[model samples]
Target: MNQIDTGLVKRLIGEQFPEWAHLEVKPVKFSGHDNRTFHLGDKMSVRLPSDAAYAPQVEKENKWLPILSKELSLPISTPIAKGNPSEAYPWPWSINKWIEGETVTKQNVRDLSKFAAHLGSFLVELQSIDASKGPIAGAHNFYRGGLISVYDEEARDAIENNKDVFDETVLKHLWDLALQSTWRRKPVWIHGDVAPGNLLVKDGKLCAVIDFGILGVGDPACDAAMSWTFFDKSSRKIFKEVLQIDEETWNRARGWVLWKALITYDANKISNKIVAEESYRVIQVIVNDYGR
Candidate 1:
């Protein structure tokens, strides 16, 4: 919905695939905090990076998508065309195969029991995939970085950029609390960001999972945080049975939700007051339950 240039997109398409010169470019309203996405008809998608800082990750996404798609036994929008991605464009651009479906929300996730079953089945399928096949080089940081290291850099960057939206004292206190939260064993491959926006549903069933930008090997707790987003206690118990996660893993998952919630506010000023307030609600749960 923002001011997107249609002509530039057409030019890029022509440059990448001169054979598709006649195809019309249409804008899709879907986007995330990191990338601007457009649907190129029913079978292809085009993405332009939101910021130069994300170029490296965009590059990684381009490489990893096809690799993981083959391994996950699921549908994915693999890149077809790419731009040089220097100062001229400021950020990278990629065209991908369009994946169709609506994102899952609380409305779509109505039958909590069924939804939990679906999630459990999906996680089992995801975990069964051989990690050795899609070995993502340069992705070791994600598994090991954890909250303690991520917040250190985030705080340092906030200070350097003079983006003092959060008070330093408050940020340090919150970061300390998040670090002290119980973290489980090393990691298994995780979605990293498993919010409602990334999951797709159709006809009351989960059809596809998108947004692989944060896809990496990390704490399974990262994905388990989805329990708070949808599953209630009963549904979550069912989820554990279907996925075969033990109680110790479940506890770490609860810790992950709190830890991820706390570290986020230390860096950026959330634009939506409602979301900020809701995040604080989740933060309070983490503090009372896990913060020692």
Candidate 2:
């Protein structure tokens, strides 16, 4: 694990908010693979990239998060600067008004109906945001370690190299299904990673979503695909109804799940047992349905 210099984090925050100089600044650990997030009192926060590769997308969030906060009604982290002094921070960074909430858990899934309504309203509001004015141009071609072509022959070379961790037959099946089901519809702005962790719950209702670093314009199904991560069939039905996803979009959503599952399996080859198991589960569900 690369060590994050909390001194640098403190220095950056101190420079960004000089008035809060005496407020306690402590480093807090959060679950995420890409960006570094920290709490700032009860009403604000800051995030920095652990990987330099995401610098561009980090900048995009700095530019577009405010627009989404304004025109869209969903709870979002609104960017606030210390009175136009944003450039004071060393790398591209943004300060967000602290949204009070907690990460929805697996137990929360039992209340799928309530979660569905919250998630449904959020997606509907997100899809309503006009894509024409955002600073981001098109698909987030560079996010997710920039592996948009998840099934390219060359892409699977490492997995092929180590045949033990991956099943060649299952991999091939998922690849074929994904390629055949690629999107044919018009692209729109999407919150690319709508996983449960990004969702915020307060008072038994979803209050807001954070982590816009993966926001982009793409097949809206990329957002809907999260159903596999956070919802079951009944809850997903409510999700689909709210988003108005059609048959083709459903296929593309399935493709999104397959590609993301493969990526997760590949990246966590050595570290996470849970990710590997979940990847198999996603594949099983997809293959069973596709076989039907």
Candidate 3:
């Protein structure tokens, strides 16, 4: 992952697609961790994988985004051009049609409950789309739609290491609850990283989803993680009703949120206070919600 500044983007565009060589290549304010995104003029954006681990997502999105876009009403990332590997950059990249709207946040949304329900419905539509030919959960998408058990050891280690910081007994109980069942029905599509940064809103309404680096077809529980990570009790209830997931699946979803938060907490608790606090807060939310 080289420093993905405007200059590198300029050279890549200039060498590859000379037609848009002169367009201003500026960094999007919230460019994500997996990919380096820069606005390619007004209508499009250039996204390059930030590391080898994320490089494969460019091709995966290029193949499936258009098909998924057709089935869902909300705008997902749409690839307009596939950039080749050049001397300026090593890995293949993408030129996507820029979707408008800022990333979602509690302060920015007009009505929290409505936003939650709306996002839930959008996810329902995404799941309903045909995924017969879609990629199964694996390393490419970080096993998002697969079993939360894939990271069992890592999650356990995080919890054990942070026992002094977190309630070990409660965290262990939640972890066991997650392994209670498998996705019994047919597999469905999932937006692996359904976080605030990936969701987009305009004029206080959720309108688009971006950054499908972890997109895959499998257990929908991974997508349900936002229920605890992002939403409050009332909004979580509305969103849950729309998803209509059963208790067993919901338990797995709880596990999905807990696992990530545990690891995030373990990694950042010392150096980054804000993220650590939020991750701890998310864990407590899951704990309290389960207790009731």
Candidate 4:
């Protein structure tokens, strides 16, 4: 894979978009996991997929974001121009109008419950969009809205490997409970990756949403996974009230959270203490919730 840095971005611009090549190119402070983002002058930003796996997102965002933005009240990353593959980069990239805000964090948010309400409303509006032509969940999204059971093997493996560290019996019980229910209604659009890194905060509120690499129409349960890791009990309640999703769907969402936490802990158990501990904490959150 080619290095996704400012120098490469400058070259891509100078080659493909010479009209704006004179503007300086610099790296954004918090570029996300799927795409490497850089500042293109002061008003626009350049975003390139870090791997072929994310290449399809360029087209998806170009097609849907503008449509979604018009109906959505908050700001979204809408593409201005798309750059084709060049000698330096293998996949397509995008230049987008910059959205000004800070990445969301619990510390920066003024009121967790209020922020949750605002976020919940945004999600409700997103789901309300017409999905008659939207992409369905599959490989491009790592099956984010497909089925949590697709990850059953991975989660069970993690449980087996970490028996000494975690209560395997408790985890298995929760896993069974999670898989017992599944989505049985009409599908809706989902922001496949709803983590904090994809959310933007301004004035201590969720002001904008970026990074739509996993946007698609599918089971909405995956979008609710954050309820466990990102929100407190009260705030989670507020968010749940807005979605009005069924209890069975919420169960599958718990399975979604559990799968990610399990693999994450298994992978980093020996390499990074902080990440390993945090993953364990997320798992414990699910376990405690299940006991209720």
The top-ranked prediction according to TM-score is 3
lDDT of each residue in 86-179, candidate 1, tens digit only:
3335667788877777888777765878877887777666656655544332333354214434545654454334334434454355455445
Tens digits of per-residue lDDT, candidate 3, 179-258, equal 97899788999999889999999999998999998899999998988899889999999989999988898999999899
The 10 consecutive residues of candidate 2 with the worst lDDT sum are 139-148
Model 2, 12-89: lDDT tens digits are 667666776555555544546666766666676666666665546666776788778887666786777522223433
Question: Candidate 4, residues 101-125: lDDT per residue as tens digits?
Answer: 9999889999999988998899999
Poorly placed runs, candidate 3 (over 4 Å): none
> Of the candidates shown, which would achieve the greatest lDDT relative to the real structure?
3
TM-score of each: 0.74, 0.82, 0.98, 0.97
Off by over 4 Å in 2: 1-5, 82-90, 135-151, 154-174, 181-186, 289-292
Compared with the true structure, all predictions reach lDDT values of 0.62, 0.65, 0.92, 0.89
True-vs-predicted CA distance for residue 156, candidate 3, Å: 0.8
Better of 1 and 2 by TM-score: 2
Distance from true position, residue 195, model 3, in Å?
0.8
Relative to the true structure, candidate 2 reaches a TM of: 0.82
lDDT of 2 at 62: 69
